[model samples]
Target: MLTLLVIFIFVLALTYFVTRWAGSMQKNKMAGSNIQILETMRVTNSKYIQIIKIGSKCFAVAVCKDTMTFLCEVNEDELAYSSDSRVINTEGFKTILEKFKKDKPDN
Candidate 1:
C-alpha cells in the first residue's frame, strides 16, 4: 500500500511539472522578435488604441473585437526614451500622435 501511494505521488508531481513547462513554452512562443507593444488605452469595453513598435519604426492603431485600423506612423525622433534595462519611453503616446499629425502634410 505504501509503495502504491509513493508511485502515485511521483506521477502527480511529474505531470504537474510537465504541464508547467509546456505552459511557459507556449507563452514564450507567443511573443516573437522585434514586435513590442508600447502602450494601450481602452476606448470601450472591447475596443482599444495601441501603440506598437516594429523594429525601429512605430505606429498607432485602433483595435476592436473584429478589426484593427492603422491610424498613423510615428517618428522615432519625436520619442523621449529613458536609457535603462527596460527601455520605456517617457513621452505619452497621445503627444506623439498629435506631433505626427501636425508634421504630416494633408493630401
Candidate 2:
C-alpha cells in the first residue's frame, strides 16, 4: 500500500513539471510573432469572432470548426486595449458586506 501511494505521488509530480515545461516552450515559440490574436469572442460551441493584428493592420475574422472567414478591417484607434491581466476592484469586501446588510429587509 505504501509503495502504491509513493508511485502515485511520483507520477503526479512528473505530470505537473512536464505540463509546465511544455507550456513555457510553447509560449517562447509564439513570442515576437507578426500575427497575433488580440481578442476572441465565442458565438457558439464551435464558432468564434476574433480580432487579430498582422503587421500594423488589425482585422476582425469569424472562425468556425474547419473554416475561417474575414469579416472586416478594424481601426486600432477605436479599440480599448489593456495590458493588465488583473482586474482592479475599487470596492472593498467590508464595504460590500455593509451595503448588503443595509439593503437586507428586517423580518
Candidate 3:
C-alpha cells in the first residue's frame, strides 16, 4: 500500500513537469509569430467572435466549432486601448464597488 502511494505521487510529479516543459517549448516556438488574438467574445457555448492582429492589420472573425468566417477589417484608430496597447480595465474593484454602493437605493 505504501509503495503504491509513492508510485502515484511520483507519476503525478512527472506528469506536471512534462506538461510545463511542453508548454514552455510551445511558447518559445510562437514567440516570433506575427499573428495575435487581440480579443475574443463568446456568443454561445461553441461560438465566438475574435479580433486578431496579423502583421499590421486587425480583423474581426466569427469562430464556430469547426469553421471560421471573416467579418471585417477593423481600423486600429477606432479601437480603445491602454498605453501599453492592450485592452484592460483600469478601474480597481474597490472603486467600482464604492460607485455601486453610492448608486444603490436607500431602504
Off by over 4 Å in 3: 82-107
- Candidate 3 TM-score, C-alpha based: 0.71
Q: Each model's C-alpha lDDT?
A: 0.87, 0.91, 0.93
Candidate 1 residue lDDT tens string, 1-107: 99999999999999999999998899789657798887788999999998888998999999999999999998867866556635646797899899999999999
Off by over 4 Å in 1: 1-15, 30-32, 80-107
- Distance (Å) between predicted and true CA of 103, model 1? 46
Q: Write the per-residue lDDT of candidate 3 for residues 2-87, one digit (tens) a residue.
A: 99999999999999999999988997999899999988989999999999999999999999999999999999789776577575
Q: Which candidate wins on TM-score?
A: 3
The candidate, 1 or 3, that scores higher on TM-score is 3
RMSD (Å) per prediction: 16.0, 7.5, 7.6
lDDT of 2 by residue, 1-107 (tens): 99999999999999999999998899789986999888899999999999998999999999999999999999978888676523456796899899999999999
Best-fitting candidate, measured by lDDT? Answer: 3
Specify the poorest-scoring 10-residue window by lDDT in model 2: 81-90
Q: Is candidate 1 or candidate 2 better by lDDT?
A: 2
Q: Rank the candidates by TM-score, best first.
A: 3, 2, 1
